[model samples]
Target: MTDRLPYWRLSGFYLFYFALLGATAPFFGLYFAHLGFSPERIGELLAIPMLMRCVAPNLWGWLGDVSGRRLAIVRFGALCTLLSFALIFVERSFAWLALVMALHAFFWHAVLPQFEVITLAHLREQAARYSQLRLWGSVGFILAVSGLGMLFERLGMQAWPWAIVAIMSGILLASLWVPNAQPEARSDRRARGGFIRQLRQPGVLAFFACVALMQLSHGPYYTFMSIHLEALGYGRGVIGLLWSLGVLAEILLFMVMSKVLARFSLRAILSASFVIAVVRWLLLGHLADELAILLLAQLMHAATFGAFHVASIHFIQRSFAAGQQGQGQALYATLSGIGGALGALYAGYSWTRLGPSWTFALASLAALVAAVIIATRLSEERA
Candidate 1:
């Protein structure tokens, strides 16, 4: 709530960055489909960037922490993401697209984990206020999804790359606006624990496992939900609205996240998200033609992403030392990338061989396993 916080600038970075996600996540599969790539090929295309995330974040994050140049790193990554993605205009062939995906994602995924540390450093002790700023990213996502959906409905996915490039340009500009924020200094004795040692803590390990499982469960949704909806006879405009609806729900959740965090344990919040995810995927897979059920399932994004994400970031803030925050966030990003890559690969093959129903059912199973892990292993003592 301090006047000194670069609220708009920080929020702007998330806005444009997730704006990019809004364009890519909901529409990319459709774009590839237009190019006549098979479901398995589309999944492989999607997996490349996610696989890059497993390495890129850690490499960039280590440099940021070591150099104390986190903002510089963000700026560099944003610039590279734009430059590499521009190559999309040149080729649509599988090998060509794969190279584009790999190059752009390497630099693209590097930015967020470092930026998370930057945002947290700025928030300082009032980390609860994070939801207020992060909500703008949801707004950006909503705008991107709905607007691009309409544009695609009218003009087609041929123009999708242009929209994405524009969003990435915004991310580049926003990165320049955000000021660097160093982590608050702490006592020598308190900062003494090693990063690997923190990783070994039971709660920390369990949290990582549960989060990876959760992201793994999201593969089908991220990779093919739009394609699935299209196959079911929904038009681009309607599909866009459906995607926006989920993010709208996420924005509402974020608006009250501070209050929610004040009242609930992270374990409870994450547990609820996993349980809801189980239902959400099932509803998505089995009830595609039921608009009411689809709407309800979309709303579950409030728990699936909003609650789970805010809670996870807070957990990292508390668990890691000031010096290790960058790596901590990177590790989280790395694991998420790994899970997402595996999920995309599995979902792709499943969709082609077993169909969408089985693909989403597998996602539900992953969420169910995550829920069980949280209930059994994650410490209830965390707030």
Candidate 2:
């Protein structure tokens, strides 16, 4: 195994991929609204891609494990995404959009989990620096969302799909260099017999439960934060700025995470994230109109999202070594994906009925529940 590629090159690739996320997530609701989609329609469309996350990634991981062709999966996913996005231009109906979303998503969602395995192989000794590498992804996201928001302010809403297409083009171009990044050899273990047996382990199950709750808690924010901000009289540009602020803090946190995790335990970081969320969500829910309070809360993205995310990845890496990485990464995706889908759905249901204040308050409570689960269940040693 080549243990010695410059970190930035690998990180740069991640930067481009995640930046694409930043572009899509914070503003897509606006695009749907501009197209005159009802809140339900917009939520359904926003969620269609995530639903694919639950199934597609696991399938791709299975194939990558069986064939040892991880990058091949990624390349195919990238191409499929290009094709899928192109389909959006064809008909502009709900059925067409949903089908396109699901089709591209089936291929798109599968790519990342396999590639995560590939990235860990490249990380070698500095696996903890994964965040530093991932943070550029945050940078890409900020640049994309904020820059494009300003452009949309000028160009109007119909240009939204074009912006998405352009970013997808960047991903396709980068995919050309990605195949060489695949792991030379992967863990021999495939998720076979007694996948439940593996899940039965107390510590491992505990970790999964915590992560699931964390994502579940994110349901409201992920589903409606931008929409809530928009309702509060913020323009698209400021909304993107708020989104960028959170991710920018996330990037800074990622830069220091390698060191931070070394000094602290995973439980410690995750627990702190939960505590911060208690305040963060309350602030967002109760005092959203107050800009200063909101900015402070946004900065907590460092702990709430950034630190917690790195810790989760490290937990997976530490728990599953070279031979079991495929299974480990798969499990991570399963929890975050399956668990996340449910969370988003719940958030979608809660957002309109409960309204933003109560919706986010409920999300905060979910984080608190997750914290208790983690604190009570996790051990000092890896489960």
Who wins the lDDT comparison?
1
Task: Estimate candidate 1's alpha-carbon lDDT, on a 0 to 1 scale.
Answer: 0.92
TM-score for all models, in order of appearance: 0.98, 0.92
Model 2 lDDT tens row, 100-159: 888987887776677788887777666776776788788998898789878888998788
**What's the count of clashing pairs in each model shown?**
0, 1
Q: State candidate 1's TM-score.
A: 0.98
lDDT of 1 by residue, 226-279 (tens): 999988899999999999999999999999999998898888999999999999
TM-score of 2: 0.92
Error of 1 at 221 (Å): 0.4
Q: Report residue 134 deviation for candidate 2 (angstroms).
A: 1.0
